[model samples]
Target: MAADPASLTDRRLLSDDLLATVRGRAAIHDRENSFFADDLADLAGSGYLGAMVPSPLGGAGLTLREAVHEQSRLAGAAPATALAVNMHHVWVGAARYLHERGDDTLDWLLTEAAAGEVFGFGYSEAGNDLVLLGSRTEARPDGAGGFTFHGRKIFTSNSPGWTRLGVMGLDSTTDPDDPRIVHAFITRDAGGFEILDDWDTLGMRASQSCTTVLDGAHAPAERVMRRIAPGPSLDPYVLGIFTSFEVLLASVYTGIADRALALAVETVGRRTSMKSGTTYSQDPDIRRRIASAALAMDGVWLQIDQVAGEIDSEPDGRADRGAGWFRATAGLKVRATETARYVVDEAIRCSGGSTYFNRSELGRLYRDVLAGIFHPSDDESAHALVAQSLLGPVEA
Candidate 1:
């Protein structure tokens, strides 16, 4: 029998609850279309997709740290779900940002999102690398004085099922091209666009990284969320959104490592090692490696908690490299992303031939954990930015 929704909600903190959700849905998701469906439903039913919204909007009003915990736990159980759910949080953040400016669309979207409307990001493009700042998509002013978006976005996660998307593009009329002036619009309706059905990959397959085409899609001015020239209602917490986002991503991978290590321990504890009668977990060398992974996860968790506290305390100030909090977030993101790769690799090796089987949960997790290293914050340019802060700035 399927578990009760209330029972699922009550054990939000229990690892077994999370594992059961992932395990129950894993096989179904292994298919092409159904992979993300069950996970998205779980996200909606559990209220995790709306965890970022404020209480005033009928959400739980969870803090950044609390959101981090939820993302970490959920992502560890199912990486694809984590990726999809995180996008929902991103939408919630976007909605809250616009709502402070009295944007009614955002208000409406946030309300619907709280009721389980999923959102996605449509930014990455085919020709333009995210490292270089430019969007192939252009927003042209229609003869009627409105804007129409045109161009294709690649690697859009949760494409077909997602209810809303934040499409980023450049305005066609800017005299001098400036990267800072990039704009975003929330689009709903699947028409005027095609969803590319080519997301097959080695890891995070359930992310549904499909491509979307926009052919003269009408986007009114009211739909645009201008980053620059904001009014008084713009909350200062807006600046720290990226930091919080990175922290949440870091937490997920760290939790993946934690879960992988636990599984490795359980698997090896009952088996005999080739070199000795004792189990692999009993060996000092294997024990130390597990300990190392555990220590890395613990350290990253503490750093995430610390940075989240700082964001909460400084919700209305300029965030900078000088601020130990921001710097710590950067450092932690770098460490956690890299460490998760190591932890997962070791977990697979420790599990030996068994990890290769599709039936073993660790095999899927091993593939998913590897995805953390290439995520947005894990990009080389991001690390370079952090490093440049320590070094001198480069002049244009």
Candidate 2:
């Protein structure tokens, strides 16, 4: 016999009770516009923060695919919380991706994370649309084989709890002829960086992804991780970061769509139409809309799972793992985020006007889903990458 779902859930890091606790706290955090401190504490206590550490190191040692599934579950319980926590997972996953393929550059990161240090993604900037290809932040050599960063970063997730912040800047002084994009980590106690209290936004307030201001923030010689040319290349480190980020990011939004669909199904089951004198579940139009939403959601996981598996299997490199990796990752990110927006809209339409209230779960999801459009590989970029993959880049 198949094991009872409840028993299985009990064995997981995101156990049912844990999710309930997190779910119960999501609204409060959103309402107060505060960080999910309790949720983070609980997750850390459950060993979730160290889930990417190797099994021999006392971590769960989940594969990329397994971690994606767990992220979806966490997101279904709390989207903002899950989205913020995803930054930590992304770094750990990248380290694991590299380590499995004989790259020990980030082994210290893995070791530090397992020892209870949390990391945050601090790469986003206000106007650096180049995404990882370039940076507006300045990286000046400290002359001791180290570097000092000077600039501002937006959407600095896990700002409240990160012991280490991953950052990148352009090291123009290193070589006048060629400025390299330098990636490094700055510790919270290192000084020179401040978290601005400016995260208030349309939604996802619980994340407290405030703006981080770096004024001569220092990354010690050993802390400087990578220095690549100021444009796109299929470098292994670049591919590892892209794969981990895109797949995990997609999983979070997919979970939002999943939750919205479930809520819609529950709504239809109880809603009755005045003209039909029957539940919305019996209404063909309602059923059809709900089906469309479910179908869209159902289509996302397989692609996400497949891509994640490919990344896990061939961390030697995503590009080498398969052709059109940029296309695959960019396409999946756009697909999942857009699907989430579509499904949340449908769920609201079926759930009645009460869902329009701020107090409604669907309302929160609607606002949260909108944030998806702005993540890396936006709609236009994703389409461009997909087009370039098939038809080649637009002529100069």
Candidate 3:
């Protein structure tokens, strides 16, 4: 029998084996394996991947708080696999957000997504940073109430599994007399589009963050996700979407640190050094390192929990006084991600030369956790946004 998305969500929530499912077959996702082609089906079937879809669309209607806990658990099990799953959930939540806005385009995307379909984000342009306001992709009218997308989208996450691509570009052909249109479009399986699976990187190799080239992809009128409207602005669902993305991303880092700490503890328990008559665990230096990492990881978890609670309380995006909450969430994302990198590095140091061995799980975690800090949300730009919002708009 086919499992209903909503029913599956309930099962996942209530099951005592939820942690076991996330931490499944960890050895296969370790360093020597280096990929997780075998795990996606299990993940999809487990209802771990499609929880964001709404009830009307046959989804679980679970909130961002649920996603954070699940993502963090997955990260602790296998950071690489968790990172891939994180990308999928990010798009799923965003799709649900757009779908709830009562627009036809969003409605179609939401329906498809609810059927266990995947959408990839193509926001990172080539030779560009997080500042997408200066995006070069051009959308020109095709004169039949449709538009043509002619540009390249680089660093598209989960390229192979994408049933639809969410694109953001400027409508250059809009009448100059009117305001410049920054439009978000959703195109499904366009033939002209190509996913360049050339994402061979040092870390998170399983992510498949490939480059997608759009060679005049025809976006029909129904495909446009939404146009920026002049009004009070901000959608409650969009707030949920952003918060979900940030918290989940942070969870991945926290999980990485958790796993690394575990491996460090295990290694210390088993290995003994000639310099000392006892195991590494007995060494005060190693114990101190472990203690520091533990403290940092705990601090990060506290921030994530607090932020989730605050976001739930203030469902609306318009928390004028809640700018601090928003900024704090962003800062937490950056801090947790950065702290994970440090934790992994310290764990490696504590593990010594043996940490470099591919057999060591800590070695794999080190590579995976480092990638989190390089994501757009981990950098100064994200922090600056928080500061600007809390400190008032800065003069250019």
Best by TM-score: 2
Best by lDDT: 2
lDDT of 3: 0.66
TM-score of model number 1:
0.84
Q: lDDT per residue, candidate 1, 85-180, as tens digits? A: 676676676566445435554776677778887777776686564421456787776655456678898778787678777776666474435333
The best-first sequence of candidates by TM-score reads 2, 1, 3
lDDT of each: 0.66, 0.86, 0.66
Could you give candidate 3's per-residue lDDT for residues 1-396 as a string of tens digits? 011224323434324364566456555545343446556666666665567667777777766656676676677776667776776677676565455444334555556666767666676686655433445676777787666666788767666666667676667566754433344555555666777758777677666777878777776777765554222235433343456677778988888888788788888888898987789999999999989988888788778877765565453543333335446666888998889988888889888887788666787787778787666565777767876776866778
In model 3, the worst 10-residue window by lDDT is 1-10
Report model 2's TM-score to 2 decimal places: 0.95
Ordered by lDDT, highest first, the candidates read 2, 3, 1
Q: Which segments of candidate 3 are over 4 A away from where they belong?
A: 1-35, 95-108, 130-132, 177-188, 229-241, 316-326, 390-396
Residue 149 of model 1: what lDDT? Answer: 74
